[model samples]
Target: MVFGKVIVSLVSLLLLVGVVFGVVAAVRSRGGSDNKNDSVSSSMKSVTAICQPTEFRDACIKSLGPIAKNASATPKDYMLAAIQTTTEELKKSLEVAAKHNVNRETDPINHDGLEGCKELLKYAVEDLESAISMVSGSQVKDINDRVRELLNWLTAVYAYQSQCLDGLDKPEYKTPIQDGMVNATQLTSNALTLISGFADIFKSLNISVPDLKDLKPSTSRKLLEVNEMGHDNYPIWFPAADRKLLAAQSAGRVRPNAVVAKDGSGQYKTIAAALAAYPKNHKGRFIIYVKVGIYDEYITVTKNQVDVFIYGDGAGKTIITGQKNFAIMKIGTMQTATFAAVGKGFIAKSMTFRNTAGPEGHQAVALRIQSDMSAIFDCSIEGYQDTLYYQTYRQFYRNCVISGTVDFIFGSGTALIQNSLIIVRRPGKDQKFTAITADGKEKSNGINGVVLQNCKIVADRELFPVRFQIETYLGRPWKPLATTVVMQSELADFIRPEGYLQWDKVNRHENTCTYQEFANRGPGARTNRRVRWKNFKVLSPQEAQKYTAGRFLDGHLWLKYTGAPFTLGL
Candidate 1:
């Protein structure tokens, strides 16, 4: 809705995360930046112009530097340099954190929070690595074509850093960590501002941009490879066994690596025991199958547990429930998750993760996932507030049921919820509003958001009768740039005509948050009475495509490998 001519610059800034310092360092080490166009005055003028529109203008200018030797650097080069420098800065600070390691942290809460911060930093680095790979591997001119992907990854890095700082809420440790993060955070702000100001920056600097062209994959890939393997099925990355297991009609046909049964009939009696039994240096999918039972425990699949696949009998049948919340627990909101997944390639199917914390429990979480390329299918995540923390990275929730009262679905993750049920439950006696989501996007162009595609939003049975008296909304912006899209979804009539809840009475988030609806139906989907926020809109087909599961998620590339069904486009 807010598309501007400077989209070129926005896309370019996104790729800066990993390349900023790396490119300059590479140029300085391997070859001097003595190109005809990269003159001292030109570089300075360009830096000034680019940094002018950035939030952290001083940091942007300082980071770009007065390097006299790099006379031929482009705005893109400076962007990359800034990003790589930021990454390095974060790394250096985290490296110092090694001395106050998780193993040595005395307080249990501090230990968990510190571990989360450290792991989040690693994820941020991973995101930066991806950005670097995208920029460094491809032709620089092709950057304009990968605008969405670049935005997606760059925003992920921002989310990672925010969560790290926010998660390290302990006052004793917060000050030092925040002081250490000053430079990196500032650079991040500058980079986000640069994303949409490319055209203006180039114009001011009088830089010549190459003619745009459609990107094409190498011909060798077409001839030598087929993205689909096993007769138009799994991707090449999916092993034969894994593919076979997924393709099987029934779970009975597939044998798992570990089985969890409450009756002690299986290899492990508890889900925690089964997870703890994970083999070291696990290569392929490590499967853990849980039988029907209510498991009352808090489980976290740590960063070291990669490629974990945990499936249960069914959503309600095999459940993991907990009662931790901000009201009753000393831990941070990040620590209140009943089941948290920190490993990559995490898949949870046919399971129920619930936080039994009542509405009074301010920030209870059912599930918190920081795993990249993760999928939750046929699952049920239910709670009153802060139910599902779709924290960061690329995530997908399909054919799942997520029920909550306020800000149930929240986080800074690039997430897509499709073919799912989002239930608006009854609030506590004093609670007046029911909010379904809170997309925690701090940066304007960062790709972290919640996209509800082909899903149903309905008030729960208990709440439906009283929906008229209570204010029920699709969501309110949790951060300045919070984003959520309801596309091709059904909204029950109980939903308030305004459609969205305002973060405050002043409409402070009116112009910043990106809230949109595309081809949504039902009485509640009527935009006639929807809030008239500047950033809210009824998206067109082209604009809606950007939020689809396929395009928004780039699911075509890796989702096939995971055997999760996904649509690529609207």
Candidate 2:
């Protein structure tokens, strides 16, 4: 058996080598073309990487599933993920292509090389759908077969991809190619890497859907890696921070005894300026002090700003708000929101973010956070419709009041509101909806949705009298695999005896997503007669760990800086 295994390994290695050589040949063939620039080289690298070992390629693909799961995510994100994954592959492919003088695109010989891979992906997607449909229907046969089929199709695509790379291994596509060729090759490499990552993740989902408990750490690590990548590119927090981008003071806030408001020539004038100055990759403590007035602005701290703390005098006095959303920005512009934070390990204390865009129109968004390991303490997020867009990952809100109407607290992130107030505002005569949360993508590890803890839900008088009239829901799986939970939360009768609502007819998968609760006490929390029991889980101690801050949103790595309530003793 050992000998046989060794032989198989040897054969596989040889096959891989042949694929490499094939890539070289393809590059050389491209070298002969007149457009001897970097684009050809870039294509070569991308193609070669696409054909690399399955395990590594699959790993790359795994990184992108969540990216796609984000409802707010656009095609731009898709292209970006694909292009960022395979730089080395592009370079090697281009080198070989230059040697042979072959241009992959426009060259009839190389035009259809990627076709097989695309076709394979097409089949894989179909197979995936079939598998999901079966699982949803509670059937068990052929699931494993379908998984194998998907993997097989993926393998074949890679094989052909190897051949395409070989086509570039000629003198025309060799070294000494133009700088433009090099750049193109790099870009292609990155894009494919991202695309492949998504494909791999979807493929995994196609396989036996794993439980959340079994996948937390691995998933969290991947999220952290992506967060790091974002930070490296964009320094979205702690602008005035030191070399490490961390706060200078490790143990306390910057303004207990200091009257350092805005220095005439200090590096940063406003909180935004200070945030703008922080380095993305800096670790450790970082602080930003806000003076009393309500600062009306749109704030987005990208993932790069790690370990940051923004403090203010009081939540009511120190305000940070903006009005930007699809409705306000003329739908096509896709503009909306006051603050959007994508940075991990971010903390905001004694501040308020408001969207003055009153309830006349879509009036979307106050703060949209796509961050993990973050928190808001004693802060208020006020807006009309679609107030707080919690994009993805895990976050915590302590003593925070989130007020909005019509799906105000929505998006696909896993969040906790311990000791916070959730005010569901009344819809005006002109308006027609009020939902608490919308879990965009339901796929596991995509959007855990939002969780409110030890919080009160007080609706506006207009909405108070109407029991279930408000089109509200604890959450609707935006994707087919969403999971949301609320434990020990108090809900008012305003929450409609039927606590959850459906996302139209298209996404009513019975068991595709999960919504659960524990020890939730109140008129609205009466789960026996209210809410869908099938979706609402009454957790055991062990299962409850899944809802903890550190376990759910990767808060273990960055939550220390954010003064939010976290689940301990896990």
The candidate that achieves the highest lDDT relative to the unseen native structure: 1
Could you tell me the lDDT of residue 129 within candidate 1? Answer: 69
Top candidate when judged by TM-score against the true structure? 1
Q: Listing every candidate in turn, what is its Cα RMSD in Å to the true structure after a full C-alpha superposition? A: 6.3, 17.2
Q: After TM-score superposition, what is the CA distance of residue 143 in candidate 2 from its true location, in Å?
A: 34
Clash count in backbone of candidate 2: 103
Q: Cα deviation of 531 in candidate 2 (Å)?
A: 4.6
Q: Once superposed on the true structure, which residue ranges of model 1 sit more than 4 Å away at CA?
A: 1-53, 66-80, 92-119, 125-153, 167-176, 191-216, 220-253, 505-507
Q: After TM-score superposition, what is the CA distance of residue 299 in candidate 1 from its true location, in Å?
A: 1.6
List candidate 2 stretches off by more than 4 Å.
1-269, 279-283, 302-304, 331-334, 445-447, 465-471, 509-511, 531-534
Cα-lDDT of candidate 2 = 0.52
- Sum up the clashes in candidate 1: 12
